[model samples]
Target: MSLIDELVALHGVFAAGEYSYRGDRFSYKGHVSEEHARMASIMCRATSMGVHMQADIMAGSYPECGVAPAGGWVVRGPQFTVCVMANVFCFLDNQASLNAVMSILRTRLADASSDLI
Candidate 1:
């Protein structure tokens, strides 16, 4: 089966707001919104991995604001962990060049689609 197929199989699992897949597990962190849940479902479906799909609630910007980081060991409290954040798109240019580049990068890097909102 395709990776997306595998991920979609877990729609119920992710929509429930917290689940584990492949090896990465994600918790929704707060009250789950439909937008977050749907986006999370699509990401996992495309990547066959779980992801944290919560809002960026840190002083107007969230660390890891851009595309889900390429898997790395992030030590928050001395424990190394693999984390992914939803990719951010900056529509700064009138031609939308920045967003376009990011969209391509996301597709190439994570095998995920652009989260155009």
Candidate 2:
């Protein structure tokens, strides 16, 4: 199955896509509108940048930084949750299931050799 298709098949995934770091849509699958996907993409990119910046600051303080910054994040709201990677995002309604869902997505995307990170 296709990457987006596999992502959408996850238990709580309602929308999934491949988008640029600047929020331009390359492709998408599932029920989300183009506008929503782009919005999520933009948010993800911003958050990712913030995370890396923080990591950089922390690294500067340490003589030997062993851990790197997170490449992705999950944004949880009352209504939905968004999972974002370097070039992909997925929407889910159940925050309680986030860990499992992300694990599945990560494994699937890795196996498929897609640029999800």
Give, for candidate 2, the lowest lDDT window spanning 10 residues. 108-117
Residues 2-117 of candidate 1: C-alpha lDDT, one tens digit per residue:
32233223312221233344324444432347566556544544442222332223313656566343321111223211123233211121222333333433453464443421
Extract clashing residue pairs from model 2.
Answer: none
lDDT of 1 at 33: 73
**Superposition TM-score, candidate 2 onto the true structure:** 0.75
lDDT of 1: 0.33
Q: Candidate 2: where are CA atoms >4 Å away?
A: 22-25, 63-67, 108-117
RMSD of 2: 3.6
Candidate 2, 1-117: lDDT as tens digits: 876787788777888887665454557787878777667667776776787677667778983885344456678888898887656778888743788667866776554322323
The Cα error of candidate 2 at residue 19, in Å, is 1.7
TM-score of 1: 0.20
